[model samples]
Target chain A: MKKTHYSELWCSSPRFWGGLTFLAFIILLGLGATYYMEHQGHWVTGMSNQVVWGLPHVFAIFMIVAASGALNVASIGSVFGGPMYKPLGRFSALLAIGLLAGGLMVLVLDLGRPDRLVVAMTTFNLKSIFTWNILLYTGFFVIVGLYIWTMIDRKVNKYYQVTGYLAFFWRLVLTTGTGSIFGFLVAREAYDAAILAPMFIIMSFSFGLAFFIITLISAYWWAGRTLGELRLAKLKHLLGVFVGAVLYFSMVYHLTNLYITQHHGVERFILLDGGVYSLMFWLGHVLIGSIIPLFLIYSPAFASSRFAIGAASVLVLMGGFLQLYVIVIGGQAFPMNMFPGKEVVTSEFLDGVVASYIPTTAEGLLGIAGIAVAMTMVAVGSRMLKVLPENLEDPKDLEHA
Target chain B: MSNKDDRPDMKRREFIGKTVLAAGAASVAPGVLLTVAKAGGESRGVSSDVRYGLLIDTNKCADDCTACVDACNRENGIDLVERPKGQSDDDWNAQRPQWIRKVQLKDKQTGEITNLPMMCQHCEFPPCVDVCPTGASFKRADGIVMVDRHTCIGCRYCMMACPYKARSFIHQNVAQQLVNAPRGKGCVESCNLCVHRIDAGDMTTACQEACEKDGHQAIVFGDLKDPDSKLAKLLKTKSSRQIRADLELNTGVRYTNV
Candidate 1:
């Protein structure tokens, strides 16, 4: 018998309605941007032949990776038998589906031919990792949906562990497929490294947990429900460990590249002097995204502070977004080395030069819209389903109240 | 009894059998042993026996000459494409589709400069074809790599995978287009080695013709599989090499004296 009693969200605060309305406005703006950009063609955007994918990709990719990570909390409780995480299982599963939906929405809308999405579903090249990803992503929804059912319905509750295990493994493969999409690109010097697969998995853990904490805190606060401090602390610790692992993997990835003489130019371009890219990598990703978050979670001064935890989560998301921007856009900026020992003096195709990319207003709006869609789904779903628990207050605090 | 067994009738039977066997062998051998001849455009489908390719002599190609590039654009209807509104010349130039372009390379060791016209290498094992989600980017029976725009979802994964940076994504609304070369927005495309001309039995390519007309004769287009063709003979005699040969793509296009 479960000790926790799950209940539908009943917060009738006017602020809640206002927040939902704001998200809807953002979503509409995003759709408008997509429509205008598509109508004018890709020429209206910063993406060119040189820089194929832009800011939209950065958001979509991060959200998709994070979606897989969000399910980890549920998996820990059901599959790994963690008592503290049992109450979070339903919401975790819900978020996994919600984030994926939002991510896929952005990705599809940004396609050169969004109408031809039917073609993507109908025709497939098995050799392509992208095709595999489509299956993985769709399977994630079905499996996670079923997993949620087992958690919700008493009749199917016995099958929770089976679905939990399946969801856990599927999410692993799904994130791998996403990472391999870049890793399989042999032409790009920044990619083709096998470490990217595992790196993305760790990235999912960090970004997903951060987003999860933000959602948990905000939802509880909005509902005027007390969230236990002990659980938040545990989540903060988990996020710190994930962030540290991501840093370690990033270090290994860069060090391995530096060892290879052919990859030296790309390394220097990304880490040292590649202006915007270098700043994003060292400052945005490393300092603000990784190191600062670690400090907030670990230091005695701020570790226990709820405000600090929220700030850290938001920073992790910011860092993850920029890191992906570097991987997708910065990786393409460096010129491909076609001639082994020859220098391209001049070429009409901009060979041997860095490709420039500046995000348009439309792209920024579309990216943010995807995030709003994700949060909106979670909010609506919380109301519809008994996903969130009534109150996660410490028993002693409840007695005092 | 032995003498009777070796009679004239028995000897005649053996001789007749040998004669019939010899006659059958002589008549059926040609039909059974010979392979089918290499077919041209007259065939229902592009023949696998014929692999079209180009050979470029970099020594003869001059740095100032854009004849091949210009000719390819004009022949493929790429010259008719105009820059869209609100796009700068620099951005448009980078975004616009260029089937072929002039590439100038300087040797790292020696102060030697080499000029060449670069386009689709048309590798036998093209990475673009391997990565395409819809199998839109594919190779023909005659080893010509091209895109099927209808099936293409405009993902541009093929562009990222092409080591030669040959593929281009159509970015603007195509106001005008030639019947032979159908281009549109939201899809990727690249040099098809003048497949329209090939399908019409025109064996020569625009680039090869232009290079020859300029008296440089830098490009030679022919059937690489044909042992007697000039391309095959030149390849046999000269030290022609595929760019990035270390990848072992076995590209249809080869360059000499790079």
Candidate 2:
């Protein structure tokens, strides 16, 4: 591999300031929304006793999942010894940390008592999956921070491979914990399957890769530098494979649910009768998220086009959000079957009927703020540190074959 | 047959003698009677030796009566929030906190209708207790499931884990709350079997009192461990079933003729 030079992103351009300003505005708006919701209580939002978790959870979980996925580039380079991917490793680590921070912020800020974060950190429940995730998230930052340090400093470079391996393992556990948050829920009919854990891992892979690719292309374009077709093609293909894997797991999950007589109602809700859920699954997740991206990545005519690849990446992200919406919100929308054979003729609560949820403006802003936070972190980190590779155009470095 | 008739007469004479003696003692020393009553009633702290339970006779429950629900709200101070101006009544109803509710159900196959009050089943191995991230949702040693509000982070995982949909999250700040209940915003709660009343040595729950006072006598509350108790004797004589018994929750509440 040719000697690679790393440099900090120049911040003099009007575009950089404009982008940063825009992100700051969004973040401020989100904070305002958070304040209003906290002061007035959750009544101001669409969340209720039935749909307990709402829009904020959807965004927070997505960013957290994608954060683990973003480190894949670094793992491929350091753990798997891929020379072509090595140049992208530093940026990958940075983005992983940045994205997680953004996601955690949203999660914490959306809490009923954000002030009680200290209590959450101090108290520990060994049995609860949420508690384990708290540890996993913090461990990820420390381990990945060391891995990035090793990459940047020549003196500590010898530990890069070992650190990268540790980070990789921690990320797997983190994503597993996230998935199990739903999978371990035995009370809900839509969850309780073991497949959800691995399915989330695969989802992280696709989402992370797509996010990394989009950020990579955007950063390079802004800098007026050429990101070689070879690296782009490699990332595009890898993303395609991950997206395909996600589709396979989703199919298996639904098929397994279909096979169970007990799960027939839930399966029917997701596949047929559930109006919004069904639309999101079929249209947003299947077609736009998986099939369309797969087509764009594999098609000979569009495979090499930067525009097509970028568009596919964006679609994958949209699909990722839609998938979570179905899993989290749709799962809650279906009323719990307290009485299996008897129909609830009348009740104070909405029993034996679909619960309705409409996201308020505060919820929308809070969710959008998560995205802005992640992008702002990436922008600032790139500008302040020598993260991005100067160029990936070297022929010798492209010797993946 | 003549001996059995003589035995009944003798037993009646003995019961009347004891009743007269008890009435004379009560009239003679009112203060001592009060002490005796207190001693027989209040127990110090909850003990695992006794499990509190409820028996509902669905057949006796009135179809249009919501006495139990009303009593629960009054006891727990579950007041109605004025519907937010722009929101529909249905939306507000879905968000309101309800500790107990009257559910009317009709059998799909038999076309038979039943009226019953539903609340937390207080499962022996509650799913909410298992899934709570902070150990806030827990079962008391006496088998009453409850939430420790101070520890609850408002994650609402307990709501998801309750199969009966018995849990409710306080979505808005509460200005008027029962001193015993102490409800607040962003905390998940459910029926605690009137824990405060139980602690105060009241054997009957608010719902149980209301039901009996309304002349229904449909709800019975007692210690499940005592074989001589009314609940135990009723269960022995009557056919009773647990809701969603397939889950093997071993619920503290049981129903007859459901």
Candidate 3:
């Protein structure tokens, strides 16, 4: 393997300024949406008493999960000793940090009392999964930031391997904490399963790698760098495996619920008659997120086509977003099972009926802006830092891959 | 034969004595509750020695009665809340603060119907307390689970954790809040067992008082620790059960004859 050299992104180009300006515009729009929601109270959005969490959570959670997953390239190269992947480590860590910052911003801004974030930070209910996440989420920034330093600094490059190991372990636990937020909800039938922890971990891998693939291709192409065809092939195949793993976990989750007689109501709701929820699970999550991506990446017809890889990655993100929507919003729409055998004849709180949620334009804008925040971070960071490799056109032997 | 005839008279006399004694205790419960806490009052604060509770006879809960609900709203100043401008009636109805609301239920197998006013159960080991990230949802020493408005960031995780759906978020800007309730926008709240009244050394809650005023007398409020208290005595007489008893929450509120 040849010595890998990294360089800063060119900043004077018209495309760079245009892209950065577009991201800034999106971020401004998102902030405006947030201000409107906060001023009007959560009532302005589709969120209600029944559905407390809305589209913002779906966006925030997906970005956080993908953030952890984005670090996989760094983990593989540094901790697992994949020489071919070493050059990608710097940008991988940067992207991970950027995604997390953007995601956290959305999570905090969407709070009913975002100004009281200080209370959340200062006060601690050590038993609650959310408090644990606060510590884990912040801790992740420090750990990953340090790991990026090890990769970028010439004097500390020797310690990159050790830092990689720590980052790898922290991200696993961080995603676990995220999953347990839903997992520990014993009151709701849709959550409260231990399987959620591993499912989230697998989700991070699939979503993260897909995001990384798209970002890498776009970045390299913009810089006029020599991105090797073999490297793209390897990433696509790995993405396929991750997508397959996600599918397996999702199946097991549904199958486990099917065995319980009590969980039948919730299962029937999500799988059969949950309207938009059922449709998204089948068409978006299963077909688009997993199956189609697998075919596009592994198919012989699209072996040399970059568009196939890009399309597959985009589909995975869209499908993953829909999957999260089903998990967060769909889970809340189902009424609480207060009575096992008896039916709630009538109640003021909309008991015994499925909740309806039609997300407003403000909510949709805020969610998409979360992605823009991540992109802007990466764009700015790359301009000032030497995270991108100068060339990757070296098509190595298949054995190294 | 003479002894048997005398025993019947003795039994009748004893039954009347106990009934009168129980009735007397029920009437003076307010005085007992006040005296028990008066030694130190608010200065000494609530003690674990006294566990506040309520016992409701669902069979006696009138189908058309909104007395208890109306009383709670008046007491907590929930009545002052108005729907914000441009808000739909449907949305406002759903989002309005409800410390307590009437609930109707029907048994699937038996076709038996029951009407009850549902509110916070005030569980001994409340799920809301466990899930709150900021320790804002806390249980008092006397087993009253409530949200501390000062610290609550209004994340609404408590609402999700509560099985009863007892909690509500203030979606619109609040105005004309009573000093007792201290309500505001973007905060989670519920029936705090009329904690303000309890702290002020009041013996009865608004709902319990209204239930009695309207001649239903379906609700009883007293110290569960005092065996002589009306609530405890009634609990012993009736086969009362907690909602979702399988969860073993050991709720402070119990119902009978549902």
Candidate 4:
């Protein structure tokens, strides 16, 4: 086989410029919104003492989780020795870094005291899961950066396997850390289960693959290149398995919660009577995010159709956001049962009532900004760096493994 | 002769008065001596040996009374802020910082009503402290759970971790604040058990003082470790219980007659 070559995308086309401009505008608007929130204080946002984290966290967590999952393509090539996936590794690593950066930005900006981020970095509570996450997140960038270097530089080509292995392990740990952020919260009934760690790992796989497939198709379409049917078919199958796994985990999570009498209230709130939360869980997460995607990827006719698969991917991404909203916001909405058998007749801090949250314009902008930042990074990175393969078409001389 | 006698008497009386006044002033000139008598001599750090706590008797707490809550607000300078123009009353109620609140509870089956002031329990294993990424939410040596405002990034993780819903995040810029309890926007705070007053050697918190002042005396504040202290003695004799004993946080505050 002839030596493979990589090239930077020529982003001179009007479409490319238009896309970049749109993302930039959204990012700028998001920055303006963040400024307004910081100046006016959190009172301007829908978040309150009751519902502390809002829309920004949902966007931030989605990006971060997907970022880790995006690296699976590279891991399969380098760690597992799949020749077909080798060419896609560079783009995978790049997207991973970009997505993580975008997510971290939103998270940092949404802090009650964004100014004290330096303090957060400097003063570490070693016991806190968040502290560990900070380390894991930063370490991921450095390790992945080196991994990219190993892939690109011929002198360091031999080290590719080592770096790839390291990146793969780090990604797993990073996603686990993210999952444990919710899982380890013993105070919240919805979060205390240890299964959340593995559940997030599975979620990352589905969401990340969906995001990767969408980005790959869009980028190739714009570059006027073709991604082969075989490659798309492989990714679609993997995504289907992941979606099924997520459904299984979710079912187990609910079943476990049901088995415990203490957790019945929280389980009931999410699955039954809790209005918006229940709908988001059932319709958004279960139906659109998991079931539909599973059907699109597995059904013989739909599996071969690119449009159906693409639609499935987009739905999965949307479902990821809805799932996070249910977890983060819905968990807080349910009033904590401090007194088991007694009813709180009245209290100053709105005890015994479901906390309400309506995302403000500022919050919505901030969330969109995270997505824009990630997309902008990918667009600019692809343009400037030799990240994308010339073509994904298999050579006639090379035999299928 | 009469004038001479009066002048001598006045001079003698002035000399004796000056000597007594000077001696009195010398005895307590630095005021450290006065504190030494009250605090058992040399000024020292808050000791871990003494876990400051409150023993609340819900049976004696009046349903209509809000003296403890009122006093806590006044003492902490948690004054009521006018709701933002478009903000609903419910939103404002949730947003407003409440270090202490009066709760009225009724048993589901028995219909037994009880009134009590609920605030930060100051748990020994405080979830807020454990969850704080920056150690901003901390438990003092004396077991008073408080936030280090300077380090708190206002992530509200502490609020999420708190089981009792005791923590409050300051949502807006605080215009009116007491010098003692310096609150601000974007930081999580809760009942610090009146840390400032505790450090100043005040035996009772503002709530306890107000409750006693109202002649109810439903609350008793003292060291939990000292066997002779009222709180410890009461715990030994009375059927007092921690709010959520199942968590086994060993909260500083205990309640009797629920």
Candidate 5:
């Protein structure tokens, strides 16, 4: 029987303090960088004519996609009403809100005028993909936050059930917006396919499941103090399905490109020929990201343990970064025109065309700082609030936070 | 012809009377009367003649001679500081304006390299104007795509939306300017088609003038709608091309065949 004692246990975790300090340090660094950029200009970052987007953009987009995926637990529980996965509803909702907040901080810093972010909202452009993405993300965050609050409230509000369904649908739409930002460039032959939006949705599952599993494991080990055997078994099975889907989606994403030779020129050259992007895509995404994690998640013996699931999640996260690295940086690495002959001629002569990009030391450091801030928030939130329930209640009581 | 000739004189007197009568309407349209007054007493000047445009013959364009670039800088008070040959947007100051940029192209079939001057395409339905949230970027009725610097919040969405890579943000304060134009920091800027010169009834851009001075009518400016205008006649006489035609951007600037 769980004791009714009201003494707050969450605020006492050592991980909570450590995470908070790390996040604070990162926030301070980001503030310093913002001040420099505002005074100095874009030159403070490594973006130029050729490499228009640099490290912060790639990292921010990865986090945004990852954050959307991270909310899958809430989506599966609230919408699907899957009896087996109902236990993680509140945790998933909290994570979805936290990670999105962190991801937004990274994006806000990357803009030319961070202060003008309000202007982006006040003045709306119906046609711009970025504008649409902003609206989708804001709506997604609000609905998810409200859904979680209603689920956790003492009264067991029925309204959350409706919002839960809405959150699930909106996430699918949000991922599509992310994909279309790149895919809708009709003039850019590299990204003119219908597969990209679906690809983003699939990749999010991989990222979301991995992140969710890792967070659950961390909470069990250091925060909640216990995760029962039955819940563990169920999470492993759910992860297995997602892991399999991720593998299938990746194969289809690449194999389809190969099937259509006309569309595969520059993208194929980079993926197959070991260009700067190819090395990362093959090693980071395919090998480390997909294969090893898929094997670990499938293995019956290891899948049961928190350690194995956490390790596999680390690999999956690495792969997500590499995947984004390839899609964004690799996409830009080649000139817009896929005509090999024209590319050869232009690279030889034009000033900005053949220009290669690597994130500067400052950019890399600052981007890392952004990730640290999210980690800090999660740690602090878990410490200061009951982010994790202290004891596993019966599956019937799982509906309550 | 009689109707056209007689209306201008009658309207010239009537225009003054109408201006007095429409004083309240004139206040509502802050800059409308100024433009009407500037049109200078023609009931309708040749629509073809009054609305000027530019036609560039790519074949005759020189690889280098920035005479047009320098003249435009001098005429409009553009600042030129030495930027490193290649610096990324992240590393550059945020307020540098590159209104006119040079693009170097090489023939794929024949290994001949050439420089092409690139600026805002000034599209009939400009994507930049379509995508601007605050209406900072607008295409004037006279066919100039311009940014109102005061209203621009420096979001750089238009910069991302542009396919030609024509727009550049002002990355730094350029204190030493050539022509005493009101240049500011922290804004996206591109070629404004020399509105100051055009509004004063100038026939062409500084670049076009510089091209004419070199004895090659390489860059010709006139109205595309006017059948007898050089730009219209060139399009009619020759099969002209536009860069990145696959985007279907419907660019106002047309290139005579190379």
Candidate 6:
């Protein structure tokens, strides 16, 4: 085993520093955006009647799914039980917590009345998917944070293990709950299916695997260390399996929607001819998110190299972005009743039926800032706390540290 | 086992008595409502005028009366210029709304058209009330569906849950809204059955008043429960239908065949 200085491994590399700086700048931008919104109401944002929820909502959902996926290392350790994932388990935990915090920040700022956010918990609408989502997210955040804190502490109590189990159980439930929000909306022609919840599960699994792979690669490269062939092979194979599952689910979600006449109206319209939203849903989410990433991860020759894994991870993340974007934006693109040009379709007094909303430059900038904030938090936390295990390759090497 | 059967019988009789009381209240309630109004009107030295609700004969809707919309905006202190369109979560009338919309639907095959005014159905069993987490969206004693903005969290779940899409989310503060019905962001809003007017013993809505003034009493105003009221008489003689009856919402607003 190659011995390295503990201090050097824990310190931030130049790339890490640069990434941190960029991330901080973006967070500052997001803060500025939030301030502007609070002072001036939602008029500051480009959101109007048609596209009420835009990039912030999309990014929030994406980050939430990504953060859930980021916890896989710990999940594997507790449930799947493997020493291979142990090295990066703490890092994953930290990333998961940090990313969720960042996601919540985006969502909180997106609200028209940020002051009334706590009312979400107090006034729980049992039938509302959104109300359930708030509860699930809050529960998931608390449990995940406690689990991570316990893992770092040397003399943890038995309750910590219980806490870890609670986290795992609730995380699974939360993903299903997120899925059910869209799944239960029978009135919405676009998203009425039993498969949506399972689809979200598969998506969460795919995103989680992709997140772990990318983070693992980053830690290895930045720490001037490398993974064993066995571990890398296992990860690659697991990613391949997840990518295939995601592909199958994605195909089934749309194909099923297309098969039914009632669903065909809005589903086909959005998928085939519903204009820009259709293009993004079909090309960005399905083609790039599912097909390309599946091929990259599953191809044995491609999956073996670090470069290939990195490429696959990037593809999966991109796909995840489009996946959420399509679900949120495409869900709204179709006229509510699937009948267009009617008086209801075009507010007779107003210009159009659907109020048009495009994310402004400020909205886009704030989204980017949210991303930077998440990455910076992860980088900073890792450096200060020595989150990644220093001598995972060999215990004898730990003596040197 | 025999005692168990007798126990259910005792419970059933009590339930029947309670239901009979409720039904009797439901039947005699409209007359009582008018009598109480007459008493109040007498005390206030105002005319004991007939209380009216728009019957909205779909057949005579002209399938296009921007007149009602214009008058409602002018009378109810609604913003006429900035109209919300499409599937939006955040609408301008997120709170403090006055003008109600009437959507014209065209049959895909026969080319036959009908105007469906998209207003709060003032349902006897409003799902908005059943599903409101905070009891903010409620049905008044007289049967108008209204929301208490002060307690509303503005989550817009009621908007999503409402099958008819009658509820609107207040996205911004409407400082210029009539002081009687001032509203801020984070509330779901809808037609209050012109409750402000109704409370003041004014039977007709701003839209109905305007429509009547235009010599187009395409809108008939009366109590549904009153046998002699125009709305009740129309229901007994004519084949009137409520929108989306399949939902089993039992909406108060009914329209005759076009």
Among all candidates shown, the one with the greatest lDDT: 1
For each candidate, give its TM-score against the true structure.
0.92, 0.91, 0.92, 0.92, 0.83, 0.80
Question: What TM-score would chain A of each candidate receive against the reference chain A?
Answer: 0.97, 0.98, 0.98, 0.98, 0.88, 0.87
Report the poorest 10 consecutive residues by lDDT, candidate 4 chain B: B79-88
Over 4 Å off, model 6: A1-9, A12-18, A157-161, A338-356, A392-401, B1-55, B80-99, B123-143, B169-173, B185-188, B220-233
Separate DockQ for every predicted complex? 0.54, 0.45, 0.49, 0.55, 0.17, 0.12
Docking class of 4: medium
lDDT of 5 at B6: 52
Which tens-of-lDDT digit does each residue in B132-232 have in candidate 5? 65677877766778887756766565765566656766655556654434555556777777877776777788888887898766788777777878788
Candidates in order have lDDT scores of 0.91, 0.89, 0.89, 0.90, 0.68, 0.67
- The CA lDDT at A160 in model 6 is 54
Tell me how far the alpha carbon of residue B181 in candidate 3 is from the true structure, in angstroms, after superposition.
0.6
> Over 4 Å off in model 2, which ranges?
B1-44, B80-85
- The weakest ten consecutive residues by lDDT in model 2 chain B span B79-88
Alpha-carbon runs more than 4 Å astray in model 3: A395-398, B1-43
Candidate 4: DockQ?
Answer: 0.55
Candidate 2 chain A — worst ten consecutive residues by lDDT sum? A392-401
What fraction of the correct interface contacts does each predicted structure contain?
0.76, 0.73, 0.71, 0.86, 0.25, 0.18
Candidate 4 lDDT tens digits, B1-258: 145575887777888899999998988776766676757633566778989899999998997999998999899988744455676787788888889998999999999998989999999999889889999999878898999898999999888888898988887777777789888788888998888888887888999999999999999999999999988999999999998888889999999998
Model 6 per-residue lDDT tens digits across residues A1-401:
44322222453457777767777877898888877765655655665433446788778777777777777767777766655665566777777877777777787777656677666558765765666778788888788877867767657745556776787788778778777766765445666578988888778777877877787677667766645655666676777677778778878888887787767767767777767777877787777777777777677677567677778778887877887877776775555652332323224323223334567666776677777767777777777775666544543443332
- Compared with the true structure, what per-residue lDDT tens digits does model 2 show for residues B1-258? 145575887778888999999998878798788778867764554689889899999999898999999999999989643445565676678788898988889998998999889999999988898877778888888999999888888878788888888998887767787888888787888999999999889899999999999999999999888899999999999999998898889999999999
- By TM-score, the better pick of 2 and 4 is 4
Model 4 chain A — which ten-residue stretch has the worst lDDT? A392-401
Report each candidate's C-alpha RMSD, comma-separated, in the order given.
Answer: 14.1, 16.7, 17.3, 13.8, 11.2, 12.9
User: What is the per-residue lDDT of model 6 for residues B155-189, given as tens digits with 9 covering 90 to 100?
Assistant: 45455555556665555545566765655655667
- The digit string of per-residue lDDT tens for model 5 on A57-135 reads 7777777777778778877777887654565777777777776777777777766666777777777767777778889
